[model samples]
Target: MSALDTDRYHIFGVCTPKDYCLFVDYVIDEIKNHESSLLQRIQETPDPALRVWRESTALQGTDIFEIECVKDRETAQEAVEFWRAYFHSLGETIIEAGHLCDRLD
Candidate 1:
């Protein structure tokens, strides 16, 4: 595995209406396909400040899908805020949001 790969998980629980699945998936696909993705941003960050929350980032599950990323705790929090702002700016009402690091149970 590469130096950036890790078993650590940064999981964010995001909620929206069930009807928003298409919209959510669309945005995720756009990110995955484009340069503005979280992974891209982390890769582009200069060293001394460089960080990674996941080897891959995707919005998974149904309307209540959890975004599961990777790496450290601090980076996980940062990732949550990054996505939270991104979705909010797109006019999505984040009626519910939460985040957790690794597995506790």
Candidate 2:
């Protein structure tokens, strides 16, 4: 379990290896393109959406990723929606590419 697991809600998912690679690249580019704005958002929000990506660790040899979020059901739900939007923006669907689950630790 992650250190964040104890106090945070988690959004977990599994995707194709291909999609996982694509997501990593996309997030890298996104950070590059919006560093200043992203940083400002991080500074202003105690639990910014991107915090999950920042705190996550890619499971070696698997397509699973789990995002830890602030321990609020509403915040967890928002993160779930955020990921769904991301998949949609990438021309994918959660059902086709993988699945998402939320839980508090």
Candidate 2 Cα misplacement greater than 4 A, ranges: 1-6, 18-61, 96-105
Model 2: how far is 101 from its true place, Å? 7.2
lDDT against the true structure, per candidate, is 0.40, 0.42
> How close is every model to the real structure, measured as TM-score?
0.41, 0.41
Itemize residue pairs with steric clashes in candidate 2: none
| Candidate 1 ranges beyond 4 A from true positions | 1-6, 18-61, 96-104
Q: Best TM-score goes to which candidate?
A: 1
lDDT of 2 by residue, 2-105 (tens): 74445445454445454352222111112233444433433343443334432452323244455443565567666666777786688763442222222111
Clashing pairs for model 1 are 53-70, 54-70
